[model samples]
Target: MAIWVCRAGKKAVYVEEFLKQEKIFCTWDGFDYDLNLYDDKEKLKEKIRKEKKDAEPTAINTWAAQLMCLKEKMQNGDIVLTPNENSKSYNIGIIIGVYEYKSEVPEHFRHGRQVRWLPDIIFRDKMPQYMIYSLGAYRTIFNLKYENEFVELLAKLGIPI
Candidate 1:
């Protein structure tokens, strides 16, 4: 029962129905979403109504497809963007790595020193992690711990996801 932010103007009339219908076509990222109300349990609960029985699976597929599509683009280092309907706001981020790793710091260095080239890269577990265009100057690396932020980044891209 995720609360979907909807325009509070004329479009509010069709929120749930529109979501039910659009789930068949695209990922439904709320537009003009009121972030302040996002965490308001009672408020959001009041705004989000259950979809018709059949629309439920469609919604789940919509979610999975959204995740899969974003995952694919992420494998290619693409960012995902969810543009606001008014075109004034967006959510952006990228996924930069798979399986986390230890620093590989040697016994001597674990306490202080770090070797220049001691880390290892595993191929099978690798996912084409990404860094946002904004971070290009900073050199996005595969080992960054920026919080599955990259996934949010995939949403900001023009890709289908």
Candidate 2:
């Protein structure tokens, strides 16, 4: 996905339309964020200027993202899930499954990772099938490029694995 930075004031809305993009995140400070909604440049720019605009990462989110990334890389069968040192404490047991989120999870338990303390994650496609830890939460799957980043993130989080 591509990200863009635009100046505020007069041309913001027009620019948004011209760019064929619709979803806008109002980063304006002191304002409640409306995700998946549209906002003009002034609002977003004010957010940029205030420095209180965005949220800091929480441990849960960071951990969730890392797990999801690893799940995507998994192939079916038993595998060693290497965590970044910050989060290596997340040792898990044998994963007895591998499938996409949509097909695998039961309908009653679909709150993403939020609902489950330690849901199994799996990547549907790969050399081996995944154990499937973060089934509902992965926005995108991991490829080779993210391996180092995952390790770094977990290491920073304090996991030795």
Candidate 3:
């Protein structure tokens, strides 16, 4: 299965919300439509441009790709790692459900996926340098480059991989 790095928010502002809600989410407030409806990134980019008129073309492209990745590319059973700045650790979890637009929730967290979080948290200091570097990616959502190493680490930690 694929492994993903899904940041809770800038500096992990929504980490607690994610833990409490038992899910991971993306925050593109004005784009309320379901991502599954868009078959291509270009179409999504067009919609993003209309919603975020102030955003640069590059930013629009990036958002479109990231949103698509979260919605379409990521599959159920894929492993997800979300940072918890307060604890200075990462929470490991399994993606357990399909994407959903929860309109009743806060605007920044409308797009979401169900997750079954593992009980253990991987501390930053204890992680290998390679894993640390991989998690340093700037994007909000991305595939973890060191997938095999990550699984081995989890095995060492006695957590089911």
TM-score of 1: 0.22
Worst 10 residues of 3 by lDDT: 27-36
Q: How do the residues 46-116 of candidate 1 rate in per-residue lDDT, one tens digit apiece?
A: 33323223346545444333323322223323322222333233322222322111235222111111111
Candidates in order have lDDT scores of: 0.27, 0.28, 0.87
TM-score of each: 0.22, 0.20, 0.93
Task: Kindly list the per-residue Cα lDDT of model 3 for residues 96-160, writing each as its tens digit.
Answer: 98888877878878998999999998888877888788889889888999788888888888888
- Candidate 2 at residue 65, lDDT? 42
So what's the TM-score on candidate 2? 0.20
Residues 63-88, candidate 2: write the lDDT tens digits: 33433333332343322332212221
Model 2 spans > 4 angstroms off: 1-55, 58-61, 79-93, 102-108, 111-161
2 versus 3: better TM-score goes to: 3
Better of 2 and 3 by lDDT: 3
Number of the top TM-score candidate: 3
For model 3, what is the error of residue 137's alpha carbon versus the real structure, in angstroms, after optimal superposition?
1.0
